[model samples]
Target: MLSIGELSKRTGVKIPTIRYYEQMGLIDAPERSSGNQRRYSRQGFERLSFIRHGRELGLTIEDIRELVTLSCHPEKPCGDAHHIAARHLASVQARIAKLKRLEKELKRISILSDSGHVGECNVIRSLSDHSHCETEH
Candidate 1:
């Protein structure tokens, strides 16, 4: 068995985060030593490693919870997991599109600005008047 700190070190997750995960029911509450400190088994380490990897991949807590639940039943298909990933991918694509629009706006602003005084600056005027933008992001 490993102490909570040791588990944190091995999993590269903070002690507080581990506790939070427990509170969120992502991880099972560990056994306690006689001193009342948490002790984790090797299985706990493996479980935490799975959660940490899921989080690093930007999976939402709910998604991770579902994944954990699914992991308990090996007979189930992975379509749910694939659906979660596809949803995240769609969201990421939307954000990328929005960012590309913003980039174009910035480029337009740069072109509009001729280093004129602030009073006559086209960039400032464009910012003040959103109508100057042809596309709605």
Candidate 2:
């Protein structure tokens, strides 16, 4: 058996986050020691590591929960996991496109401030009035 602190250290997950995962039903509540401290099995360590990896990949908690359920049924097809990854990939791509548009708008506005005075600053003017933007960010 491992202490909660040891589990956190091994998994690179914070102690508070481990508790939150327990509350969220992402990981099972660990057994307590005689002194009331949490004691975790190797299975708990593996589960927490899985949760950490899923979170690092930007998977939503609900998605992670579903994935965990899917993991338990190894005989099932992997289509659901593929679908989840595809959806997340699309979201990431859309955000990247939006960021590119924002970058372009910033570049255009940044070059507009030729005057030393803020009163005559096109950058400030462009920001105050969205109409000056060539593209929607």
Indicate which candidate wins on lDDT: 1
Among all candidates shown, the one with the greatest TM-score:
2
lDDT of 2 by residue, 3-71 (tens): 888888899999998999999999888899889999999899888888888899899999999999999
Q: After superposition, how far is residue 59 of candidate 2 from its true place, in Å?
A: 0.9
- Model 1 Cα lDDT, one tens digit per residue, 3-92: 999999899999999999999999999999999999999999999999999888788899999999999998999999899889988988
User: What's each prediction's TM-score?
Assistant: 0.77, 0.81
**Superposed model 2: Cα runs more than 4 Å off:** 111-117, 131-137
Angstrom error of the Cα, residue 59, model 1: value is: 1.3
lDDT of 2 at 14: 90
**For candidate 2, what is the TM-score?**
0.81
Question: Residue 111 error for model 1, in Å?
Answer: 8.9
Off by over 4 Å in 1: 104-127, 131-137
Superposing every Cα of model 1 onto the true structure, what RMSD results?
A: 3.1
Q: lDDT of each prediction vs. the true structure?
A: 0.90, 0.88
